[model samples]
Structures are given as C-alpha cells and as structure tokens.
Target: MEEWERWERRVQTAAHPVAYRLMRAVAARGPAVRVPRVGVVVSDAGLARQVLTDTEAYTKTGPGAAAALWSPVLGSRVLITLEGAEHAALRRRLGGLFTQGHVAGVCERVLRAPLGGLERRLAAGEEVDLVGVVRDGAAEVIRELVGLPAGGSDFTEAAAVVSSVRLWRRSLTGRQLHRARAALARLSEAAVESYRSGDESTVPGRLRALGLDEAEARGAVGLFLLTGTETLVSFVPRLVALAHDTGRGPDEITDALVEEALRVTSPTPVMLRSAARAGRIGGVRVEAGERVVIVTLLCTGAYGPFSPERDPSETAGLRRLWFGAGPHFCLGMPLAMAETRAVADALRGFPDLAIAGRRPARGVLIPAYARLSLRAAR
Candidate 1:
C-alpha cells in the first residue's frame, strides 16, 4: 500500500475526514473505483441508507469481526453498535437525561473547568498546548458529570487508555483490550457509589430514578463518558485550531467567527448503520447483511452539494446530525456544542492569538495542528 493509503487504513475511522473523501470519490465514480469485493462505495445515498438505517436486514450482530473487537469493551448494545428494538429501547430509556436543557447545564460546567488551567498557563508566560489543556479539561468534566471520584488523576489516564481503543481496527491487542474492560468496570463502580452518596444532583434525577442495580448503573459511566468527553476532546480544539489557522481577526466579532469555525471544522466524520432489511437505496442494490456508513462531517459542509450558501440554513440546527442522527443521535450534542461555543467566545477576547505552528497540518484524519499554541495578548 502507498504511504497515504497505509495511514488511511491504519488510524482513520469515521472520525477522520480523509476516509469520507475516499468514500465520496468512490460513490461519485462508481463501484469499480473501490475494491469490488470489499463492497465499500459511497455513490448512492440508497446504499448509505442500507448501512445506516436497515437494522433488521444488515443485522449488526457478529460472525463479523467489528463486533467481536468492540462488544467486550464497549457494551454490545451501546448506541453505535446496537440494532433493532434493542437500540430503540436504549435510546428511549436514556432520553430524559439528555434533553436540551440538561445538556446546556452540563456545557456550562465543562466551559468553566478549563478557565483556571488556561489562565494559569497564560499567567506563567508560557505557551499552552491547547490540545492537552482541552483534553484534561474535558476529562475532568466527564468524570465529574458521571459522578466519578476525582481523588486520583487516574481518571484521565484511564480515559486515555480507553480512548486508544477508538483505533481498535489497527493496534488493539488482547492486553490493551483487557485494560479497557477493567477501566470501564472501575469507572462504573465509582459512578454507582457516587450516585448513592447524594451525588444524584450531578446526573439527571430521572437517571437515578431508573432503578438500575448498582452494577448496571456503574456500567453506564463508561458509556456516558465515551460520548460526552471524548467527542468534545476531538471537536473543540479542532474548532479553536480552525479559528486560529483561518486568521479570523480577534476583533472580527467572536460569535460569527465561532459559527464559521463550527461550519468549517466539523470534527465527527462518520456515522455508522446496518440495513434493517434488504432493499435498494440511492438506486444501489444493498444486500440485507451489508454494513453502510455516512460521512456527515465532510460531506455536509461547504465542500459537498449540501453547501450552506445554497442551503441558507443555520449550522446549529443541521449541526445536530454532526453529533449523530435518527433515534441514536448523540445524547450529549447540546452540551458539546455549547461548550465549544463558550470556548471560542472566550478566546475572542484574546486579540493576539495566532498560529503557534503552520496553518494546515494535515494528517490521515481530521485536520489538526501539530502545535496549537496561542499567545494570549495583553
């Protein structure tokens, strides 16, 4: 394989924009452009729907490899990997906790936790690695929101260890897999203990009222944090980096710049689905058992046919799908977007912010800066 192809195969999951580009090329060109036997093509939205919505026909279950890799670590039934009524039931069960109002409340807290860290770094007259700052901040918020103990920094480290599994198609081994499972157990137990100790206010009252046994509730900690914290870590800095790289003048009205950045740099790349039943989609014949993916991040923005110029729609409304779509749409989207808006809004006051490194640092995945150091101007 060529170098770029190797990178594309190795690390780029749906989170990586390049994968979307490749898929789009195949879709537009025809099946012949893609590996014929692999059956990955993006040409027909019909084919896309087959993988995304046809839960019954495609059967997200395994004899296939993806499930075997993920089912043990991420519950076989977590929203992303689930199918049929099982997926619907879980979505409904968790609905009350992730309503708009609740998500907004969580965003408020996530936005504040990082202020002290950023301020301290600025006060010391040292350059800040925005990625590290954002990662730590997001990790802290996720643990606290899930009602986990902040006693040790282990939460962040454990989170990093587990997040590594996001690249499971490549480097995952039995040992790392075992660590991820154990970490989930630890985090879940802590969440259950915290809930019992008057920490019900941290999560939704309805969640606590669900009458889950301790272990079941604990198991949910990993699920919640995976969506809530990890997504923020991936997206927020990318937003900041885009704002900085695009040379949006600090005084050019922060809110507008933030909107542009969100539109320009959608961080979540791929949404996955299985055909509910065998049928045709986008004029493509989809076998009932096929898996399909939609690349919302890259395909929805100004680049694709869905350009905002012609669409004249606000990024916010359509941006919800940036989190996910259908019944399994992201539970933490409002919180994530609110936090992103707050972070960008705050940075607008720093008129001196500039790229600490090159403008467009390209990788096989999402556009990221090798170093996003901002010099907070006086």
Candidate 2:
C-alpha cells in the first residue's frame, strides 16, 4: 500500500470498521451529505464549523448523540441538553476553572504524584500500559475536580467502562448494555459524596451555587465523572504514539505538539446537533429538527497528519473546531490539554519510546486502542 493509504488505514482501525466506511463515503461526496445518519451529515471542516458555531441554527437538544444517550443516563435539562442563553449561562459560570493559566497550574499539582510514579516506572525500563497509566492519572484529576473520594482505583476503572458507552450503544445489544450498566453502577457513591459536601472549589458546590438542588447536582456530577475521565484516557496515550513517530523526545513538549495531537485525535470526533431553524451547510439546506453530525476527525482531515512543528497559519481553524466552535465547545478541553502535556512531559524520561505492539481494534465507541503497550528503545 502507498504511504498515505497505509496511514488512512490506521484511522479506520480507531473506530468500528463500518463507521470508518460511512465517514469515508460521506467525505468523498464533499463537506456535507444528507442521507439520514441521525439527520443531515457534514464532514467538511469549513462546513462543520458553521454548524457548530451557529447555535441558533443547530441546537444539541433534539435526539442528537449526547441528548439521546446522556439524557437516559443523566436525566433531562442536564447541561448537555440545554440550548441558547441557559447553555451559555452555565458554561460562563464555570468558565473560570478552565482558563489556561489556572488549568496548567492546578494540573501540575493534582497530577504530580501519579505522573511522577509513571515517569519512575518508565525510567526503570518497565513496559508501561499507557492506557492504564492515562486512566489512573486522568481519573484522579477529574476525581479531584468533581469531588469524588480519594484512594481506590474503582473510579478510574468504572469511568473507563462508562465513557465508552457513548460510542457503541447505538449498535449494542441488551447483554452489552446490562454489563455496562453494572460497571457504571459503581459511580453512585462518589456522586453522592460530592453533591452532599464536596469542596466549593469543585463542580458540585459550583452547581449548587447556580441553583441545582442536591438530587439534580448529584446526577450532573455523575454525568461529568463518567464522561470526562474516559475521553482523556482515549486521546492522551495516542499523543504519546504520535510524539514517538514525530521524533519528539521525552524532555521535549511544545505547544505545537499539544495542538497537533488534539487535531489528530480530534477527541470528540462526532458531535450531533439538531437544527433549531433552517440552515445551509456547504450548499446543503437543512430544515428545522433535522440533525447535523460533525465528523471532527475526517472534517479536520485527521488534522492533516501529526506534525511535531506545525505552523500557526496552516492550522488556522484547528483549535475552534477540535475543541468545538462556540457555546457548546467542550468544557473539559483545558483539563484534557493539561493531562496531555503532563503525559508528554513524562514521556521525556524515556529516550526511545514506541508502542510494544498493536491489537486488532476492540470495536470501541470512540476511536481508541484496546490497549496501547509501550517500551523504551534499549
């Protein structure tokens, strides 16, 4: 196979085989195509931006991915289902926590112990399970921010199972759902603890200050804990692989590396938005109540293949699209970046880092490795 074709094949392995076929087919037709995939579909970067940033046209409330799946898990009127001013208000209220400086500092402190342990293990020439390392470290960061009780690895493990539920549920059978719910059931106590009395600096307290009662607050915290940590686990380790491929050493991590990984991984690959009003994305007219699916991965062309030193002009719209464009842009991006940076910094200790091997894709909801094993060059 040619090099580019070979590289594109890896993208397919990141998700279920069928999902990749759909994306490739739609993309070939251009930026936007409508053949009923939950609704109108858009895979072009310029077009995807208009759909996401124009909140008036495409609202997330109607049967889109998050509303469809998460509402079942978190109940109605949760942040993911809100639109317009209400959505803007809640995001604004919590915006302070995600500021660039605040997130960087807080990340270094909360993630220090776990990251240091990982660095030490790699230094001893151990084969590290990058997936497990990212899960434990990312979960601890979210656990602290959301006010979950400390100590046990249950939260991390449970979150790993719970987060992927969003991706594969549409095609999942009763047996799979039941098994996933059983695993997700472990988060209840942590939510209760946080909602009842977690520190004001955390989500539960802030939610309360914004008028959510204990029950509502508890459910919201549960949603974030389940959603937040797993997404981190999926992307951060992949960035390590990208780093090694680009010849980035353990001690070298650039802002460009963080940006490129976010683009390549495109963490929230598909975002579903229902049209609140009529709209045109790349000449395709979308009616009210129709859905617009933003395939961020293909839309960004997998961010034009990871570059160790990407130029700003070349990546003009990357940040807006990858993190999301407007009001509904990911609230957890800063936290996600912080953890990615930490992973990059830790990988610096290993002079030669490479994946130990690849396993056949595990059919995950999100595009991810079933296990990303790693070894240092001897």
Candidate 3:
C-alpha cells in the first residue's frame, strides 16, 4: 500500500474494530445507506451536512443519540435535547462566554503549565507517556474552565465516569446506569459551589448568570466539562503521533499541522441524528424515526489522503461539515484548536520525535491510545 493509504488505515484501525467495519460498510454501500437497527450512515460530506443542520427534519430530540447519551446526565432540558425556541434561547444566553477571545484566555490559563512541562521534557530528550499527560491535562483544563475544584485524583475518576457510561451509550446495563448517575451527582454537587462562588468568567457561573435554576445550571456545566475532557484526551496524543508521521510542525508549518491532524483525527468522528419526519438525504429515502450517522472520518478524507494544509476554497466540503455546520457547530472550537496548537508546538521542539510504542484503545467513546510512549531521537 502507498504511504497515505497506510496512514488512513491506521486512523480507521485506531477508531476500533466496530467503527472501522462500520465505515467500510457504509463506504461500500453508498453515501447514504440504511442498516439493520443501526440507522442511516451519511458517508458523503454534502449529505452529512444536510442531515446535521436540517433541524426541521432531523431533530436532536425524539430517539436521537444526543438525547440517549447526554439526557441521562445533562437532564432533558440542556442544549443537546432542547429544540426550536428553547434551544435557541439557551444558546443565545450562553454564547458570549465562549467567544474566541474568552476561550483563548481559558486555554492560556488552564493549559500553560502542562504545555510548558511537556516542552521542557521533550526538549531535554526525556521519554514521555503522551497518553497519561494529555489525558490528565485535558481533565485538569476542562475542570478549571468550568470552575470546579481540582484534586490529583480528578483525572482518573472523571475518565472512569465518562468511559464506563460511554461504552453503553445506546444500551446500558443496570450497573452502568448506576455508575453514570453517581458520576452525574458528583458533578452537580461540584457545580453548586461553582455557581454560588464563581463569577461570570467560568462556564458554570455564566450558566447561572443566564437565569437557569441551580439544577439546570449544573447540567449545563457538566455538558461543557464533558465536551472538552475526553475528546481532547483523544486528540492531543493522536495529533502528536500524526505530526511525527507527517513531519509538519513548529515553524510556519505548525498551523497546517494542527489543522490537518484535527481533520484526520476528527476527535468526535461520528455525529448521530434521528429523523424527525420522512425525508431524503441526497435523494436516499429516510424514514421519520431512523437515525442518521454522519461518518465525518470518511467525509473529511474523501477528497484524498491527509495533507498538512486545508483547501483554500470557500467551497471546501471537509471544513463545512467536520466541525459540524450551521447553528450547531462545535462550541469549543477555539479551545480545541488552542489545545491542539499547544501540543503540536511542544512536539515541534523535538524535531526527531518518534513514537516508541502505541496501544490503541477499544470499547470506548472516542478512539485513542491506551498508551503512547515517545522518545526523542538523538
């Protein structure tokens, strides 16, 4: 196989066996195809955009993945479950808190120490466990951003809560349900203090400022905290590996490197939507209750193999759909980019950085390495 093809295979394999098979099957079938009990898979970028943003036809409510996965913890009224006026009102109230400048400030304060430590260690030729550092650092940063108190144990505990629940998003065992509820309770308790003590600078504080009740504010805060934690944990280490493979970083090329890595890694690679009313996506018939799974991993990589630079076109399909499209685009785009940049910059310091070993994670929400050991080349 050619180089890009090999790297693409690694990306698919890293996402895990089930997801790899899912994408391959969807690709072979067509852009939009239905499967047994699974729903429609929109592998093409254009069709995926139509489904994700077509709120009138594809509701985030009803039997949607967001509702199934997030409603258990965030309650039924959080942004992911709300539709029409409620969704817009909630988004408007919380919008100012996540502006580019505000998010950049959050990243700087929350991630500076960790990024510095990584740079110094890598530059000094010390070996590093990229998975542990990024995973722990991601938890720390998200907690601080949401105004929650951080203890050393927060990382492992937080990850366990998310992971245990994530694997059973569609169907939960009794034990899994209990653990998820327990974790949500802890998060809500933490948010109480943050709401009362924190200022509008923090997310929970901003949630309270919007006049949401204590319970509502806590749910909103949990959603924001969970959004950044696991996804960044996956993105940081994978980007480091991809960067080393592509040999693009540090200099003027750093921005290109980060963009490409995010494109390929596409941290939260799948977006699931349930059809509200019978409709057609790219002319494929979809029924009212069937779910639509937007395979962004396939959409973004459709044009060709991964490259360091984004297409400088107003009509680029990958950019339009990957971070999502229309009103529901990712709220943490700036923060996500900042985190990716910080890690890429540090990795750039070791021009001869090489991955010593990597073991891919399975049966988790996002694809990532359980361990990514790295050493600087002499």
Q: Model 2, range 34-92, lDDT digits (tens) per residue?
A: 87645667887878777777877777786454666655555565677688887776667
Candidate 1 C-alpha lDDT tens digits along 1-378: 443223222223334444545665665665313334333344333343434444455544533324545567666656555666766766666666667776667657765757666766665566777766666666666766666666675566555554455321423578867787776766676665656764556552335566544544554566776666556665566556544444554444354554554444455555444444556545566564454545554444533321223333545455444555455556776666666666665565566675454222334234333345666755
Candidate RMSDs in Å, in order, are: 5.4, 3.1, 2.5
Where model 2 places Cα greater than 4 Å from the true spot, the runs are 1-8, 151-190, 197-203
| Arranged by TM-score, best first | 3, 2, 1
Better of 1 and 3 by TM-score: 3
Best by TM-score: 3
- Highest lDDT: give the candidate number: 3
In candidate 1, how many Å is residue 209 off?
1.3
The residue-level lDDT of candidate 2 at 111 comes to 81
Question: How big is the positional error of residue 186 in model 3, measured in Å on the Cα after superposition?
Answer: 1.4
Q: For each candidate, what TM-score against the reference?
A: 0.76, 0.86, 0.90
Question: Which prediction has more favorable TM-score, 1 or 2?
Answer: 2
Q: Which residue pairs clash within candidate 3?
A: none
